[model samples]
Target: MNTRILKSCLLGAMLVLGGCASGLTGETYSRDEARAPQTVRMGTVESVRLVQIEGTKTNIGTGAGAVVGGVAGSSIGGGRGSIITGVLGAVAGGMAGAAAEEGITRNQGIEITVREDGGQTRAYVQEVDPNMSFAPGERVRVLTVNGTSRVSK
Candidate 1:
């Protein structure tokens, strides 16, 4: 019974840990809203700034790490010492796992400023693409929908 439970827990942890890693890049999309018909605005690229997109922490790392750490720490000693080590190991593992998830999932982004067809200007920040480079004064199409936007040539 104990062995089966341990195996199941480890499997679950591994799956959740996998989710902590980042997915595909290139095109940018909003996480808070669904896709709608985008409104396009013709513009010229005014500026582009390099930036970092922070990763999310959903506790999968902490939970997976605690489970794995406790399992490993259980083999240390016999009584009080074993219990203390297991607890400490679990706590340390959780923190390390969370950091690992953050490091893995963090993204590189760019903040692009555009001068629209009219006198108005707007700025958008999105994930950077190696294939897409926006030069100052270059023409672009600003597509926006549901409070999210992207700039493309």
Candidate 2:
């Protein structure tokens, strides 16, 4: 049997196994649970907009993919052919890994427009959590403590 299929399998396996984790807790700060003065603004939701939130990008995916692809590609041929295949495989694997990582690490956010009780309007783009949601005219509290803000019902 030719090594093409084997190489493909190896590359696929590497991509699946060698990936990085991006921790997005949606909280601006951590470790300090100490009580801080929070500016609570009671408001009603005027609008809710769906948005895309960028998490992060580390070289782990691309780097791991390239290494595995190069090794897999090298096994299929010899001398110059092997080298060329290795380079090609590395490029493909790296690209795939990066795309996969980006897809996996993506976060969902919502742009919430609220009209305060004092006749002022504010918009907050916050990470979407399954436990939290808002609708038009729903009474909610806007909490901002130490520059970090969140809307809670």
Candidate 3:
């Protein structure tokens, strides 16, 4: 097959094997954690963006399905049948792959909370607009000169 396809397969395999674990925990934090007081603006998630996302899976299924479909379709007839079979196989394979991937990933909703300069907290039901942005909490960075500040997340 093509070298690109081989590389993609290898890369996908590696990514699939490497699990994702980065997420926030519900554990509460105290003001002492920051050490200093911080002033900032913030927004709350009035609602979660509940998207019925499919999980991610390997592309092997799609490739296999396409190959099988093409072979079966081609075998059914001779010249025209072969072409039709190949096309059908490719489409079927793609759909199968996507579905499989979605099942594996089981992607779900996201609650985006943004903070602004003011203390006023606004709750949005929909996904936050990229331009109309808010900070998650007060931006309290640890610096050699500035030091740390208390910020709520």
Candidate 4:
């Protein structure tokens, strides 16, 4: 009974955390970006560097962790001891959960520096796409929509 509830809560938390992540690849676009016009510029890749994209920090992760921790901790003891352990568990769980959520959603990205045809140089960072690779001297397209830009072959 208690185990079932715990499992359900954990599953729910996982689902919520998973739903929070969205695609950050060059080929991915948000719903609002669909049917929108983008400005395109031709550029030559000046450099490419690997980077890490940070994950989100949200109350959902912390709250869910706290709940799970509290439940698990409260089950450990009785009376006041249970309450104390529950509180401590909630605190520890919250921190662990937040970190877990962030780590799970973090992405590998690339910082692509490009020299535009207009003689302007800029760097754009996007989640690394397994299907596309960029080299320093390769020609690419810089597409900008609503001030957000991505580099693609």
Best candidate, TM-score? 4
TM-score of each: 0.78, 0.71, 0.33, 0.97
Candidate 1 whole-model C-alpha lDDT, 0 to 1: 0.76
Model 2 over residues 16-98: C-alpha lDDT tens digits? 54444332323444445337777888999999999987744667667766766777777768999999999998998788766
Model 3, poorest ten-residue lDDT window? 141-150
TM-score of 1: 0.78
For model 1, where is the 10-residue window of minimal lDDT? 21-30
Candidate 3 structure quality by residue, lDDT tens digits, 20-112: 312111222334534544434333433234344344456655655455455445555668877887688668756665565456555443344
Cα TM-score of candidate 4: 0.97
Going through the candidates in the order shown, the clash numbers are: 0, 0, 14, 0
- Give the alpha carbon lDDT tens digit for every residue of 1-153 in model 1: 546655776677767766655433336554644457778889998998999988767688777778767766665787998898789878877887687667667889888899999878988877788988898989999877786677878
Full-model lDDT for every candidate: 0.76, 0.74, 0.43, 0.92
Where is model 4 more than 4 Å wrong at Cα? none
Name the lDDT value of residue 105 in candidate 1: 72
Q: Which is better, 1 or 3, measured by lDDT?
A: 1
How well is each residue in 14-118 modelled by candidate 4, as lDDT tens digits?
999999999999999998888899999999999999999999999988999998888888888899999999899899889988997998799999999999999
How would you order the candidates by TM-score, starting with the best? Answer: 4, 1, 2, 3
